[model samples]
Target chain A: MVNKENKFNDIVTDNGKRIRRICSYYSPNHEDRKDMYQDILVNIWKSLDSFRGDASINTWIYRIAVNTSLGFTGKAFKQMQMIVDVDTENLSLLFDEGTKEKLEQEAQLNQLQIELNQMSVIDKSLMSLMLEGLSMREIADVIGITEPNVKVKIHRIKEQLKSKLSGGKHE
Target chain B: MNNSKISQDTNGMGSFIDKLKREDNNLQKIFKILKITYIVLLIIYIPIFYFEIEKGGLFQVVKVVFIALGFSTFLFVFAYAQKKIKKISYAEPTLILLKKTEKRYRPFHLLDLASIPPILFLAIGLGLSEKTFLATKEFFSSDLNLSTYLVEARQFLFSGEHWFKMLAKTVNEFPMIIVFMVTGMLIFIFVISFVAGYLLWVSKYKPIRDNALELIKEIEN
Candidate 1:
């Protein structure tokens, strides 16, 4: 029998990118993001034996991710600790390869992240997965919603984003 | 943005990933320690309880206490195991998901499962018991020729000695004893309630273990 440690490794190895994506949503600061990530890993490790292979691997992981993120937010909120707010400039530097036009692009991504934060959790997850290149079907399965519902929700979310961007003078 | 910029974005994300990995290791260590400590405690206490059952007298009380502890441990283990199993099985994910939602928090409902019915029954039972005691005495006095019983009962009804005259025709019987027991029980229940209410007010239900299951799930999720 593959022991728990090996099983835990298999999960992290397979879902590393997905886990990091979820962590990024909850983490505002570098340290907090790290702590939240650790908490998620801990929770996943503790709960792994309970995963009965009924749901697809992705859905099970998403459930744990969502639950852990909520737990992290609740604890941080109690400490009145804000998530590590992404520095738009630093984030821009990471993506902007020192080009003059990079400033404009960085500003857009920062605004996007901010606007994304304003969206509901489901909306955020949907958009984040879409940005990660996940298919609508995969996203729907992870969220336990139908594909049609996913499309509808995505369309509505996009409309909301459009209004927010226009109103805020996204430049 | 060019592909090179996308590459850098991914690189920065990669650095954060390493940090997450380190954090996971630390959490694993903490959980392992906790699990080991609890297991060790169980190992030591189980044997102590086993011997306590053989000591007799005061040890009997100790044995019962240990048995209660053992039973409670079993309950906790069972609950923990089921929670683990349910988490894996996806028995009711929607309910779990709903419980995880923030707007539907219902902390006190958990307590209702165990506390509500018994509390209502206790109040009703005590009330009916007191009434029956009174009605029985009245019926015996009026319907039956229990004049002697009543004369004996009247003596027990009121407090402070009001002795019967030397030639007093005593009708009170031991019927009042039943009334006194009922009244005493009612008083005891009332006192307990008053004390409990006061403590609840003062403590605000410190360490409220049950009835917050949904709330905790909601908040944590």
Candidate 2:
């Protein structure tokens, strides 16, 4: 039991930030993101006993996280549509004396997250997996879709996001 | 070299793990409620089934049989879901677990279809049973003078009396009218029950089936 606990802790410590980022992309509010994060953790813990050595630990975690997020969105469709009130306290925690470069990067990420929240649930899942640097084949495996389908979807989602991001500018 | 990156990662991990541990209580509470609700519903069905059988007849028996079958199907599906829920280890692959969950629920769609048979049997059976009871009562009625009337009509018709032939024809037509009325009533009952069953199925089970199918399709893809 202790060994199992240690293993779980190690996995969480290693990938927790990536999981949180993925959760943030799907969830619009601080509370929902936290809830989704907890859900993903519980799912991972529940699934830990059956983890064969077939897939890399990272691949396995991503699959659980993505699937859990999709399920969460499906269950809370109305909540997903509700406008998110930015939690200023949590936002402030990310800054350590707020350098200009750091602020600019944060702004860009926030803009991307806003646009991501507007996309369909499937598109969001695909985009987040792409952003996480998963290979097309890995994305296809995690999503249970063909590799070609993942490639097409990624291309289209990128174009869609680009248009949405650029459409807001005067130029 | 990148102390800020390490700190940020640590902070994110610490906060998330803390939140997850705290929410474990809520998850347990929800699971408990679900289990209790399922058990309560199953208990309620027992007395209901008993009462249905206590109202005994051929039609009642048939209705009870079908109801039993429907309930058995529900029990089987519920048990399967419970078992799957139990087997969900923290180590299972997400895709595999999701697929199993989908399969566990797929059988419940058949509950809507299972309901139709009992309704149809009950409706037709009731109609037939009612007609038999009424026919038996009429046959045993002390006021029924049908036999004497039939004999007199036959004799008069054989004596070449044209008016008595009409009486004999009218006597024969009485049974046809009863048959027609019984047939019409049976059709009415069947139609009403079928429509009721269909509406119930649509209202209750259609959404569940659609949701299950959506999840299963996602997994299959």
Candidate 3:
């Protein structure tokens, strides 16, 4: 029992760091990142008891973490109801000589987070794992989709991201 | 509205979930402490009651009765504490603030009324046992017929005792019996009130409660 608990804790520890890093990519503040991280941890712990070993432990943990993060993001959206509609012309007016580079980077990251949030939970999971450098087959196995489906998802995601990035550039 | 907007929404979600996990952990700790204290008190008290009964003989029933009431009151207070803990677990602190803002009050929801009947039966059983003991005392003291003993017992209780000395003893002893009845009645009424309040909250005010729960989940999330 102790050994099993230790193993579980190790999994959570590794997965938690990944979750935090993934969450920080989107969340701006300490509190929001912490909340997202805890949400991932709690979901992982809750789902642990039902984790059959058919999929690798790594795959199972990542699946729960991604799904939980997506839910957290959705709930936050509903709670805040904050939507930024940046005007393309106004963007130039908002930037200053001193903060121009910093503002651009922050804006780009925010735009990317928003685009990811709008995607389906599964799509978000697929894209996030792909971002983590997992093979398409591994991503498919983790998300319970076929490799061909993973390929299709990645293709669509790339298109979506490109359009979003282009829209951000226009703004 | 679009992808970038959705991303900003999810960014805030992480913080809400962390707060909820911490709160749940704290509540679970409090629950464990209460359960441990209850078990410890029960172990210490049960033996003391048995020792008192053995030393004082059965006629020292007054002491036994007082001890029983004390133990029971202690138990009732514990039960009340447990009920409170259960409610606090379900009742999110954030939702209470929301209710105050909405000017809507939450009625107390009670547990099952079936818990009352067993306690009521126990109280009645104790009263009957008291009657039997009184009849035995009369049989020894006055050689009164069993039926006569029954009449005297009823009269002494309902009509008040005629003999000054007997009246004092009856007054002293019968109050314990009355205590049992009063507590039993209070328990019965409380149980009934609990059922009524819960039903009213569930049927008439479900949406309000649901909204409260949602607000709580939102705050926690």
Candidate 4:
């Protein structure tokens, strides 16, 4: 039991923010996000005993996180729309000082966020994972799709994003 | 590495996990009950086969078939559920997990159908055992050896007088079979309606399942 609790701690400490971020895209309401967060933790805890150390722990937690978020539409879970909050903390972390350049890039990111919200849930989820810096291969593994398929779908999505964000210009 | 620190940092996640487990949905409880039924039926049939095998005629056949059905049914459910849980690791790939999630919330589970034949076999087995026992009361009354019981059981089975008596006994108790069958049918209907009504409407998992399918389609396409 101590081992189990220790493992749970390691998992929550390591991946709690990642899990919460993914859940935020699904649940707009704060209470529902907490509920979604709890559900993911419960799943991770239940699945803790099954961890055999084959894959990286993050990837395992990630799959569970994504799987739980995708199915987080129970009666208790309000069908709250996805609300993408700009990561101001990360933005500050990225740009130490508030400069003109930071503001410009942040505006572009805002536009990108709007485009993302216009996307289908699947597309948005893929985009979110991509922004989370998962490689195409990792994304495919997490999603149970082929590497080539991930590349194609992500490429198509990028093409659409560039065309729309660039005022219909590709380059 | 400090578990106590994690509990403090995460606001007592240990208790939260316990809370979630306690508050799990009723559908989960139902599945757990069904799993227990597997062990219960397997344990039940062992003693049943032991007690009736000495009858050595139709009684033996009925008991054997019913017990075999029970054993195989339990084995199939256990192996199948374990395979599903073991094969699809949340760490592996999302598509396998997605398909699994879709099936988990599937309005109509195919696994439930596996119980039908065993149940029907049991009902028929009970009826046949009843007929055999009614005909060969004299066989059970004596503590005869197997060969002697088998010879007498065969003789009584072929005798026209016992056949008539058996038919009369069946007619006299036919209403019990009707009641059993009616109860079974009612249970089946109740389960079906509950799945469609509760899981579909209340839990609203169908849309979630449909969304998973949509994602699968996007990825595969």
Best by TM-score: 4
What DockQ number belongs to candidate 2?
Answer: 0.16
Every model's DockQ: 0.11, 0.16, 0.03, 0.40
**For model 2 chain A, the run of ten residues with the poorest summed lDDT:** A82-91
How much is A40 displaced in model 4, in angstroms?
Answer: 2.0
Q: Write the per-residue lDDT of candidate 3 for residues B1-221, one digit (tens) a residue.
A: 33233223345344433343465567667777877876787688668657766776554455556546655655675577566544421111223434442334366423343345445544443444455556545446664466754554455444433344344566455333343334344655776887998788787666555554554443333
**Model 2 C-alpha lDDT per residue in residues B33-125, reported as the tens digit of each score:** 867876786688668667767988765566556555655555565566556566754333434545555554453345446555655554444
Which portion of correct inter-chain contacts appears in model 2? 0.22
User: Residue B150 lDDT in model 3?
Assistant: 55
lDDT of 4 by residue, A30-118 (tens): 77778778878877876776888776776787788777766665332233354554552333222225532444676766765566666
lDDT of 4 by residue, B1-221 (tens): 66456555454556564454464434356667877887697688778777778667766776688758756765677668766654544454677877777788777667767766766666546656564445345434546677754443444444554445446666344323333233444465766877676755445676777777877776677
Q: What tens digits encode model 1's per-residue C-alpha lDDT throughout B35-56?
A: 7776786698667656656665
lDDT of 2 by residue, A92-138 (tens): 22223452234356565566557656666566667667766788888
lDDT minimum window of 10 residues, candidate 1 chain A: A80-89
Instruction: Please estimate how well model 4 matches the true structure, expressed as its whole-model Cα lDDT.
Output: 0.65
Please state the error at residue B129 of candidate 4 in Å.
Answer: 4.7
Off by over 4 Å in 4: A25-28, A73-111, A166-171, B1-4, B11-14, B20-57, B64-68, B75-79, B82-88, B103-110, B129-205
Question: Over the stretch A35-144, how does candidate 3's per-residue lDDT look in tens digits?
Answer: 76666665554455456577676666666665555446544433322122222222322223443344357677477557766764445445557656677787766555
User: What TM-score, computed on C-alpha atoms, does each candidate reach?
Assistant: 0.48, 0.48, 0.38, 0.66
Error of 1 at B42 (Å): 18
Which residue runs of candidate 3 sit more than 4 Å off their true CA positions? A1-9, A12-17, A21-26, A42-55, A66-171, B1-35, B48-221
Collision count for each candidate, in order? 20, 11, 10, 5
